[model samples]
Target chain A: MNTWEIRFAMGNEAIAEGALAAGARFYAGYPITPSSEIAEIASRRLPQVGGVFIQMEDEIASIAAIIGASAAGKKSFTATSGPGVSLMQENLGVAVMSEIPCVIIDVQRSGPSTGLATKPAQGDVMQARWGTHGDHGIIALAPSSVQECYDLTIKAFDFSEKYRTPVYLMADEVIGHMREPYVLHEAAGLVSRKQPDPSEPGGDYKIFDFERYDDHIAPMPPYGGKYIFRMNGSMHDEAGFGCGASDNADKFIRHYEDKITKNRDDIVMTESYNMEDADYVLVSFGCSARSAMAAMRLARQEGEKVGVLKLMTLWPFPDKEVAAALKKAKAAVVPEMNLGQVASEVSRYNERKIPVIGVNRVDGSMITPYQILDALKGLYLKGLSLKGL
Target chain B: MKQRWEIIFSGVGGQGLLLSGNLLGAAVSVIEKRQAVMTCTYGTETRGTFTKSDVILSDGYIDFPEVLDADVVVSLAQIAYDRYVDVLKPKTLFLYNSNQVKEAPSPARQVGLPMEEMAAQAGAPAAVNIVALGILTALTKCVQPTSIQEMLTRHFKGRQDVLGANIKAFEAGLEEAGK
Candidate 1:
């Protein structure tokens, strides 16, 4: 084992390192701008670590390969950007319904369709939350720094394994390429999903049955294992068989939902700075949080009781903490690279209209500290009291 | 005491921005045993689009990932200078290629180096980034020159000829800074 040490790595390369450190054995991805480097590094590094790296023909196949690899009892992952993520939606949904454990990273660029391949955008925040067509649950983590790129990636894999569902690692172009010093721990803490019991008869091993288990997260067996059950996208029962009954749909949805919702305390992760008795709070995530922190410090120096709330877990939105912050805050500011994604959600909780300010930038540029400071000044000039709700 | 500096390397694609970022990062991380992170961006156009590589080196944990206000912004292209001038603090140093960036200084401490001309003079036109790195270390003392040389040797350990040219280019840059 090696001591913790700081290392320089591009965003893509850092993801590969994180994935490998997390015990990822298979990488299936198609090269795309801003994210191709991830594929490139995986190709070089995965094999060196006795893992497999396959460049699939397209994003669909890439995700499918990971899904299949995960089912074969391997920790698998794939990296993609906007269009590629769009292509993998059906399979992503498939993985959701089948309860497969894997990690999918979207190094988001500007897009509806290749909108801005080289530019940074948080447009996919909503997509990551609700991109699939059905009412399925997901675990999405947004990393603000390169170390988080490595650290959160490990967390993404862990969450995927613990919950038995596909996890999303959302990153923007600015973050994907930006370099920072990060410490690589000698041994990363990883959670591997429980494999099914091999002693049971192959027919008796119900892959999704968990009536006797403690939680909704059903243990699964790899294909070669005794539990050779069929899995599909349709709502299924304990046997992993599609059931059209509405009751079955309820059971199916609740299964994965509980896996995450019940574990909310363990899954929900956030960072707060000077927010305990803050008069005002800033809610921001991803790269924009960097600017928000700088702005908050400046605002505090100017004698404003301002603080910042950074969200690490994007999906299963940290509602409890957010609501508590809002309750104690006079006004809330939501700043994002996107126009109004998180702000829209903040408004729902803030019915008091305590001036939930939205500071947004959609240009191909990263939001700077000046823009954030300007927004604070504008809010102050408007005579909005920075007090508690 | 080990001091860590987060340096943002900005230039256009094909200017070896990512390569330079990697070289500098590898030098610091692999040689000095310091923590380093490097991220790069290349616009759609592979040849003439704006490209940037930001590197943060630290002895402690680097919680924030993005560059807030760069202590040193190295611009090798005109567009890089134009786009990032407003981001640098007053004390921030702007180091640009004398042959490429024909812009005025936006920072209190600014120095333009003849990177292209110097690399050409050193008989390695593609070593502009290395030369610029040399000049940058001299002016800012951001990283030790000897440490960088150690990095250079490790970077080109397998190729002696390329190593020789890069070392030569680096010396030329050091001499230019000395002038």
Candidate 2:
């Protein structure tokens, strides 16, 4: 085990190093702008570390290759952008339904359809949650800085392996391409998948065991192991056989969501800055969170009683934390690259009906701190006017 | 020293703006044990296109990576200089290439160095970016000249000729700044 070493690194480089540190032994990805660096670094580093790096023909094949590699018992992952993720959505469902442990890095660019190839955007927040066809719980983490790009990628793998599902490290082009100083520390609290104990098993082992593990998560042994079981993508029984019975279908489908939701306490992560006596709250994630933090600091310097709630975990939505942050605030501001993907989500938890303003920009540039600070000032004055009434 | 310094290196692509920015960032963050963040912007086409690298160095945390207000702005091309000259803060130190940028009408305290001539005299005309970096370091003292020299040695380790030329270019830049 090596000690911590600090170095200046790009966020993509940090993420690549993070994946390697987290014991990722397989990478199959298609290169895209703003994300090509990860594939480039993985290509050089994985080979040196005796891991496999494959450049599949397309995004669909790249995701499928990773799913196959994960099932074969290698910690596997892939990196891509929006169009690439759009291609991988079908296979992403395969990982979700089959419960394969893998990591997918989406270095988001401006896009509905390749809108700006090399520019940064946080447009994929909602897509990361609901891109695939079915209703299933997903784990996605957004990194605000190069350091979080390193830390959260390791956590992404840990969550994936532990929950037996695909995980996303949702990085925008700004965070992905920007360079900063970060400490490379050995990954602690690393969790590998729970493989079945051959001695304690009955005649046949359940691949999707809902009984033994109260979390509805079962042991996932490698394919060549002595425990022979089917890995079904359809509505499946504990034995991995397809089941059409209405109750079994309902139970199995609910298990996918419950396994994650029941463990939300452990899964959801958030960071609150200056929230103790905050009158206005700035809620954001990914690169936009950096702007929000800057804006909050500026507002604080002016003594406006502002704070920031940065959501590290994008999916499973960190609802309780967000609600708590909004509970005490007079108004909430969401700054995102997209029009209002996360802003709409923030509005849902505004039970107080406080104004939730979104500082949106899709012009292939970052949402500046002044833009957010201006929005904060507007909300502050509006509060004053209401008090005057 | 100021608590934080925001610098922008603006030029056309293929001018090594990003490399210069990265070198400065590494020197400050790695050697000086401070914090630095650099974000770059460039068009899809690689060469002869608009490009800029924004570097922020702080003794404390840097929340926003991009340069909101530049303290030092280095422009190596007329296009680059023209784009930023009008928007500079009055306190900004605007450094430009004397050969490339002809006009300089701005509120900033401007210094036009013969960076291209310096690079040529240093025997690596392509190392004009290094010359600009040298001038930036000399003018601001943002990082120790020795630290940048160490980074240059490491950055161009395998190619001895390139290393020697860049080191000379950097020294030339430092000397020009003294003049």
Candidate 3:
């Protein structure tokens, strides 16, 4: 493993290489803008690495194929945009109920439905958390730079394996298309799913042993192996037999929530920039964080105290840390490519009196640093005073 | 750190400005080992549409990645030149090909060259991008000539079909930029 390999790579290509480095053995995706480059790179690189690359008919089948591949004991993934992700919601629900481990790389674009293919947006911030119906938790990580696109994709896979759940890399077109020189590490820190030892015996070995719900994990037996059991969407017992009892349904939801909610500390991650002794803060993630950093520099230049809280993991949102960071600020600004999706989330945890102002833009253009700086300047001037929050 | 310099190359589709921008970043950031960022956006039409790329070579971190204003802008076609001319700073160094463009934005900012014709004369019309890159490298002094030559050698090494002509055209650009 060469530790010093540097290349001028786009965000999408970096994702494919990162997936390879993380030992992803299968990929199924349909080429869509912003995210199409991931499929293109995977098609070329997966075969060389002795992995399987399947171009499915549509986004639904692409996710379905990866889910099936993951069940069959292969590290699998798929890439899509907002439109495709919308189609994947049903299958994603199916994956969550069955606890199938897989990765989804969603290069987000501006959209309610196919709004802008080439433009960038963070509109999917909430979608990554609540797109699937019913009580289910998902791991979604947003990368702010081309290098993080590589580093976080590997982390996405690791979390998927650790929790036996689906993980998402919610990227936008800005980071997906931008080229930057990055050096890939020799070996990535990885966590594999706990597998049941074959010598431990197949006799009465149940797949869904609920007795271990505190860990929110069960050693999944690969489909092709000798272990024989039933897997279904309906409520199931410890041995994975279909059950309709009220108690079992209650237990199912509890364990489902416990898997993610309990491990929030291990899963939820955020990066703060110049947060020490700052009176104003900017809560942003992904490509918007780049602009927010620039805004922080400008605000500091003007002798104003400002910082940034860059969220890498969108789901299992960090409420405690965010509330604490907002305590010092009279106002916090949320600048995103979308119209205030994450801004609303920031306010929920903002128990402090800090007024979180959202500077939004979804008109097929990126939100520049100047826009954020203007919003920050206007926030304290109009919304609050120094004594507020 | 040297004062941050930005370069944008604009031209018609199929003129290889994207590759030129890529190679320039490869030369300065990779070969010369500096901080660099590169991006390009183009219209839907494959040919006859305006395609351009921007590269910023800085000694340290690049705060804003995109080029809102540039220190040097190379315009290979009349339409692209006309579109981006007004977006220049007061001291921006403008490079244009006189064969494709009829006039300059301003006499002081313009550094006109017969690059397209020189490339065509070298029997590699597609090599005009390399010629412009060489001329920009010389005019801005952003990248060393040796690094540009190394990038060209690494790019066109396998295909002998157009190797000599591209190098010749780049030399012609370098010589013309000196005058």
Candidate 4:
């Protein structure tokens, strides 16, 4: 295949293209602000490629359809906004317990409920990590730009396949509606799930559980495959037979936790900007990482040794790498669109002693470069120093 | 070792700021064979508030990819022009439509062009974006005009004849900017 050139396309269009490239044959979603375009594009494009697109009655049904389609062997995805994300939480829990591999795209807007439909917000940062209940772990990657919207969506589906779990593509309004040149690489390492061995006798198959929890990600037999087994959200034994015992319940939770927790190194990702020998470090993710990089470059030109740690993966947070960077830096500033959601995590590494400042904006607009630069200047004037972490 | 530029295009929604930035990014990526990234944010207020796009063109992968201080800033609305004028780097160049914006900010060298009138004269009312793209290329010498034409042909092949007037409008913009 020839190397394809990157050109300008809307973020929604990029998502559709990425899904198509990553072998997602079905999409179920409802129309909502900042995310409706994904459904619109998918509806028009999926039919031509022999894929399926369905506009569900609401967000609840949308996620349910996605989960159902994935179980039936088609790679499936759904995109939604603030209110829609809230409505789909229950089905997401069902998907987690059932171990169905799918992708969820949340183009987040400002609000607890329908606050600002078209405005940008990182308020759902924590929500993406802990939206569903119980001891289930999910892979969530936040794309800072339109190109990443394409690249990360593919990665999200791959992670879901590898772990036999659901993944979240958490994008904000700023990155969703933005038009950027998106070059689809022919060599973009695409990952597909493993199919169960057909040669293994049907009676020996276990769909949900096994003797050991470490290999919790068992090969999933797709629909129409020769293997025969049952799958459910309820607690089950090694043979996938329904079991209500407390030990079975404990083992189920352990399987969910072990699959993700053990692969934290492979899941966590961060990009450092001029971090070596830096006096100050700025921790930012999603759209705010764009502004933080801009501010860092300007500060460097003006003779300030400032660096940035841009997080590409939100869940399975890279705590070790972040802590190491914060150790030698004089101060750390976290700038985000929400009222400092990621700053809470940074504070967990070192509290009030590290001169940890937060530059927050809740006005549904991105934090500008001047705001971050001013915060850095204020920290310098106050002579606040970093704590020895 | 290679040419790298960070360009920003800011204006109102209907002014086609995003289109201009996209055109530049496309030209740089497809024609120049460089890795280019463009990102934008338009206000929820529809056509009234300022809309801005940041474009970064580099030979290597752009990791810290944000438009900090632009090497070139283009504006079609007075509000966007005034907002970024003083904040832009002293070396940064400014290009604005003289028909819409009458005043130029201090310090930076400003090149004003009657691009809307030129596009109208070229028989395309909405071709002002392509017109601005041509003028920006001529002023900065960042991408070749021939490469831009090749990119436009590849990008608008489906539309076909719609590009004839737009190409003429771009040439008119180049001529007007020269004066």
Pairs that collide in candidate 4 are: A6-A183, A7-A181
- What C-alpha lDDT do the candidate models reach, one value each? 0.81, 0.91, 0.84, 0.81
Error of 1 at A387 (Å): 12
TM-score of each: 0.90, 0.97, 0.94, 0.86
Interface RMSD of each: 3.3, 0.5, 1.4, 3.5
- In Å, residue B136's CA in model 2 sits off its true spot by 0.7
Tell me chain A's TM-score in each of the predictions. Answer: 0.95, 0.96, 0.96, 0.94
Question: Over all chains combined, what TM-score does candidate 4 have?
Answer: 0.86
The residue pairs that clash in candidate 2, if any, are: none
**Cα miss at A67, model 1 (Å)?**
1.2
How big is the positional error of residue A153 in model 1, measured in Å on the Cα after superposition? 1.0
Ranked candidates, highest TM-score first: 2, 3, 1, 4
Better of 3 and 4 by lDDT: 3
| Residue lDDT tens for model 2, A237-339 | 8888888899988887787888788889988999999999988889999999999999888877876788999999988888889899999888889999999
lDDT of 3 by residue, A192-293 (tens): 778886577865657778466457588887886777756677777877778899998888777777788789999888998889978888999988898888
Identify the leading candidate in terms of DockQ. Answer: 2
Model 1, range B106-134, lDDT digits (tens) per residue? 75367787799999899889999989888
- Candidate 3 lDDT over B60-150, as tens digits, reads 8776677866788899999988976666777888888888897755633887788878888878887989889878876777888888878
lDDT of 1 by residue, A1-389 (tens): 26676666666667888898889989999999778888888999989989999999999999999999999889999999989999999999989989999999999888789888888888888888788888777888998887889888999899998888999998878777876666777444578688665556665556777665776667887866666667788777778776889987887777766777778888888999999778888898888887788778777877788889999988888888788789877788888888899889878777556878888888777777677777767777788763321
lDDT of 4 by residue, A206-318 (tens): 77744434455777777545666566667777666788999889988887877788888988888898999789999998889988987887788887888999899988777
| CA lDDT, candidate 2, residue A230 | 76
